[model samples]
Target: MDLAAEVAALTDEFSGVVRVDRAGSTVLDAAFGLADRRHGVPMTVGSQVAMASGNKGMTALAAMSLVEDGTLSLGTTARSLLGDDLPLVADDVTVEHLLAHRSGIGDYLDEDVESDIDDYALRVPMQELATTEQFVTVLDGFPTKFPAGERFSYCNSGFMVLALLAERASGTGFHDLVDERVLRPAGMLDSGFLRSDDLPGTAAVGYVRMDGHWRTNVFHLPVRGNGDGGLYTTTADMHRFWVALFAGAIVSPETVALMTTPRSDVPAEGQRYGLGFWVHASRDVLGLSGYDAGVSFRSFHDPVERLTATVAGTTSAGAWPIARLLEERLVTTSPAA
Candidate 1:
């Protein structure tokens, strides 16, 4: 299959960037559609776009770095760290459970099995969620779904607790901890948790299509990112992240192995859950994905082939089709796939 042709055909329907790297070399890099439709800004290769839940990968990395430094352990429990702050969360819900999405804790912004992504309501006002601590108030009301380590269920609130744990352990803010432990060490200088309302010109504005008209996603998400999501990065910075992560620059090799190791199966998606990534065991692929109102992102790295592919879109559903096509092409043609 001609990868370029496949992506070219998607240009009309998708509005974002597609990038692929092989053996630490750039193999493909292309941009499509508008970054800021109102301002007539075209999406560029250098534009930084939001990665909603994709930020979970960095949260996991930050938490694991503390584990590497003997500051925390996978076995550390939320009850032990939080100590009655979140009274309903079970005592057995550990850091490992949260990292692997096995924490049966109730989610504040629960993505119900049948709900539309765009219509999923935020429990709190979007403008109020500025920090991880603020998220704790939102997370407080939901009852625990099941026993800790019972099964795999994606829970955003669990990660918020993990971020709190990291902060307590490191004596640093969650954002600063991630920057110091994950981004800077990975050489991702351009990536950080910037506020949605205050993004600079280099960052793409998120969009959503409503009532046959394009609309900004400014009102659909938190004002600023927390541990669960809302991170912005460039394709080039993500490429550098993959390189540094695999090279054991951010965390130790043993920690990486633990993170990428598949601990549970996600039968619905036909994938497996690792510490913070999705693992395709058959293809030796590791990925981190995110989707929210006016935000879509998928990034993958194949360890054996040293290949990386990323699709980041500024619209809610724009990145999926392109990402799926790329996955099909790579799986059928790439030697590692």
Candidate 2:
């Protein structure tokens, strides 16, 4: 099937966007279904979609950039930077632990401890937990999950601490530092952290299909996104991100290699977690995935074919199927896919 036919089939049941960049060229760039179904606004290549935990990679990169300048060190302790703000965190927890998710700290909305995002947001008033400082007290009353580096357990709070440290080191806010150091350099102009109540024009309004109907997801997220998540971006911009990241435009080539190195060994067979991405050898492609509230995203860059494919959606359910179908097509057509 052609691009249009493939997209139509996916859109018939879902609202989403799929973007493909093959050998530095756009093989497919299309948006299907609606960004705001009530207003009949359709998603476009320029439409902004939430990246959720996808922003973790960007945050990690931002922290590493400061490390490159000697302003911060991977060995720097979170306690030193945060001072009295995060007295609950262990003094030995290093920046590396946070970046690698090995800090084993308590998460405000931990998947293992907490069952659902919707329930968690209800208690906190999603709009109130906007900045890293505002969220510091969430974990203050809770004890550390493990000492500091007992093992790797994904922790949202750890990333928040990293954001605070990054901001302090650069003497700038987390959002501004990322804009100047990472997004601007990568040319991701349409992407930034936004408040839950104030979505910019051309941005997709996330929806959660519940009780056999799609509902807009406003209360399901935080008021403002922080370092760990809550970033809005376009597939075209993400394609540029992968290029800039892998090509060492944002960091040194050695640092890029270090970021891609798998730090934690997953107990599940044949899987590992890198600093900011996931390492999978299913078909010799490196990739990452993020899902939260009403957003779902996945992207892969094939080293052998020099090709990449990314899928993003306003709703969480649409990303995986689109990603799988794109992979199937690419595998059948290319020598390396």
Candidate 3:
């Protein structure tokens, strides 16, 4: 089957970029639809798009770097870093729990319980949440849902706390720390946490369908991203991130192993939760995915096959169809029984 041709045929149905690479060789690279409808700018291979929650892996790597430098440990309590500011959060919730999604803390933007992404509203105005410290106000008022080391719960608030911890321990801004300790080492020069309100010309404008009309997502998300989500990157840069990660450039091999090791089951998603990456145990694939009002992304690396696939979309649900098509092709072409 001509997978590339098939993907190309579906261009009109999706809006984004798709890239597949095997053994360091490009297999498929294509872009579709308008990046900025108002300006008539088409999506390009170099166009940067938001990765919603997809950036959690980078945040995890930043924290691990601090661990390597002896500044923080996985067992460090969230309370120690945050102090009495957020009294509802339990004192037993440790860094490890947050990384593995086992903290069971009340999520400010809970995905599991919230069926429709559009129905969920932010308590704090999006513009006010420009920094990690500013997010604490909205993160308050929610009590801990369960014990610290309990079962996994995908909590966006937990990761915001992680961003706070990273800043406190490293004495650096969360964005700068990730750029220095993660993106620079991983050769992802084009990737960073960018403010949605003021974006560069190369950045894609996220769109969502509302009342049969397309609208921008500027008001749906925070003005700036925290640790939990919101990083702008290109498809090539994302592929570079995967390659560098597997090559042990961003984090130590031992640390990567620890981070990617499956620690809890995410039954609803039919996957397992690792430190910050999603694990497909049978296929030995590790990945990061995200979905917001007008952003969608999926990127995965198959270590056994030395393959990497990425799909980044500019609309709410545009990336999934293309990603599933690529997954189908991968399964059919797999060497394993």
Candidate 4:
């Protein structure tokens, strides 16, 4: 890929970081536009940007790690940990089904139903969503969509339930456990869930275009990310994560294989999906994609070639144009419409 040229072509639409790593060395590191528009702080390669649902892969890794250690099993039911919390989840919904998106559980953020990126989707205030335990209130009222193990249905609630299960199974906070097992071992020191209200100097502020003006997305998203999304990471850290995952540092190679094995074919998306990661239809690339009210992000890695490419943008639609450039060059010849 003409990484520089492709990124430059989307200068007007893309406003974030793009990084590519090859053979364990940085091949491309570029940043554009503003990280904080009000203060005029430019986005940089080091700026930590939110990954939205892209971090679902990390959540999957944590769950798989628990399974490897016998703390949980693929057959373990969400009800085992949930007790009477979400009364709508089927008793037969297993961890594996959840991981593979076949749990048939109703999603709180149903992507199939919700089309507006700028809409106020949350029922409660954003501050009330700081902890996994607090999310149960919002997850309520949704009915089960299908029988457990019925079919592949991308679910945000499935991952949230996994986060809740992870907390109960390990007796550790979801953030701490992910850091301990997924980030720390992978050497991703630049990544973590940060409070949207009190962002650090190194973090990027997500922006939404409102009535011809730009505003921060502090109200549209949760204060702190949960199982499904809302984690901030840099391009470099993402490359490290991919390398570490493939090198058997974060989890066993066998476990990694299981997670990346294609479980369903999502033709609407023109790709396949594994347990927690988006699978390439005709290539060896495993992908991560996230799109929220103010954040857009995607990462694709080829284990055989040791290539990792990631793009993150502040506006929800900015990253995709650049992502298509990368996808066309590295992922597949027939891109999804």
Candidate 5:
């Protein structure tokens, strides 16, 4: 089967960028449709797209660095570092709980409970949320959903607090610290916490399909993303990041091992929650996926084949099919055991 062709066929259905790689070789690197339909811009391999909640992995990596340095432990109480700033967090919630999405704090943007992301954006202007401290109000209003370590609930607010903890413990701005320590070290030169209004060149403007046309998503997201999301990056850069992460270039092997370790059970069938990555086991691969407004992504590492596959999309719902196609092809093309 021609996997690339199959993925290409779906591009007009879901306008965005798609890239795939294996063992340092470009297996499929293609872009289709418009990145900026208004301006008629096409997404290139270098075009940066907002990964939305996909940025969680970088936040988790920042937290793990503190863990490696003995500044904080995974089991350290969340309240201890964040103090009165997050009075609503349960007493039992720990750093690990946030990392693993097991902290039962209320998600600020609960799509299941709330119908519209734009409605929540109205309560607080997206432009005001530029720093970790700015997000405190969002978490403070939501009560604990359950006791810490009870279950995996996919809490974005939990990660927001984690970013605050990193700032408090490291005595550095969360965005700056992550950039200096994590992005730079991982060789992710194009990734950063760009303000929603001032996105860099080569960055794809996120769009929502409305009335058979695409509208820019600047007003639909927080002005700046915290630990939960808001980093812009390219597919090639993300591939470099995954390679560095697995090879332990950005953190120790011991640290990466800990991040990859399943910490809590996901209610989603056949899935487990790690520090920041999602682990899905089917037959030949375990993977991570993230989706949010105007962004979709999936990446997998096949231990049996010693291969990796990644898909990054500017639209909200195109990554899985592309990643799946690549995965099926790679597994079939793998050398005999």
Candidate 6:
């Protein structure tokens, strides 16, 4: 698909990183724009960028690890562990329902309802939302959208509740559990939930375009990532993640099969969904995507081919267009397709 040629036209404005790895080797690695415009720090392939909702895949893995070790189970109801924190979630909502996005629970950040992307969308200051427990206040008040297991309506709060469930069941923090069960075993040394306010030099600054000016996403998103989103990783680490996940490093081979097994047909997304990853509607490609006020990311992996293509950037919209191009190319050329 002439990867370089496709990415060239947008080089002037694309702010982030893009890379492709095939069969244990790098096929493409390119960095564009800046990590921090204020400091004039150019983005590098090593620069860490937020994955937004893309982190859900990791959250799912963390929950599955608990299941694998008998600390939790798919049949475990949210009410059993969460108690009275989120009273809106029905007692029938289970861990499996949450993983498959069929929980039908009230979503804190409900996408079905129309709301602009801003800090005000959260009921409290974004900075206060640094941990999974801190999210209950903001997650409060939204009513259940449907009956449990009624349908596949994507719910961000479902993952948050899963994190809470895992924590209660495993006696571990959500972020720490993910690190131990997902990132650590996946060989993803560079990925973790980094606080947006105190980012390290290796991480990119999330920037939202506001009124013809560029601004940091510090105020528009949570201070530290929670269940639904907010984790940082380099393109290199992301590639490692895909490889390890399929190699049965993060979860069992049987569990991997379960996770990648398509559960619902999402026509709106033009794809099907497994546990936490997005499944290709017609092919063997698995994808992860994220978007927010100052973050955009998408990663596609062909398990059999051991090929990965990822587009991650600091702006809310930069990576998707390029990701669409990559997906089209992959869908056509994937061996399993």
State TM-scores per candidate: 0.97, 0.92, 0.97, 0.97, 0.91, 0.97
- Candidate 2 — which pairs collide? 126-223, 127-223
Candidate 2 error regions (>4 Å): 1-7, 120-122, 210-212, 267-270, 282-284, 328-337
Better of 4 and 5 by lDDT: 4
Q: Is candidate 2 or 5 superior in lDDT?
A: 2
lDDT of 3: 0.87
Candidate lDDT values, in order: 0.88, 0.79, 0.87, 0.91, 0.76, 0.89
TM-score of 2: 0.92
Best by lDDT: 4
lDDT of 1 by residue, 1-337 (tens): 5777888788796778899988867878999988889989888999999999998999999999999889999899888889879899998888999999999999887765567777736767888888778877888978888899989998888889999999988899999999999999999988999988899998999888889988888888889887889999989989999889989999998889889989898877878989988988465688989999999999998878888899999888899998898777775477744
Tens digit of per-residue lDDT, candidate 4, span 40-104: 99898899999999999999999999999999999999999999999999999999999999999
Cα lDDT tens digits, model 3, 1-337, are 5988888877776778899988879998888988898889988888898999999999898998888888999999999989877789898999999999999888888887746665437976788989888988889989888998869999898899999999998899998999999899888888888888899888999887888988888888998887999999988998899888978999889999999999988878878889999987455788899999999999988887888899999887889888888877774357851
Please give the lDDT score at residue 204 for candidate 2: 89
Candidate 1 vs candidate 5: the lDDT winner is 1
Alpha-carbon deviation at 242 in model 4, angstroms: 0.2
lDDT of 6 at 45: 89
Angstrom error at residue 165, model 5 = 0.3
Candidate with the larger TM-score of 1 and 5: 1
* Candidate 2 lDDT, 148-239, residue by residue in tens: 77888887777788889998888999988889988998999988987768887778888887778888788787777888888888888888
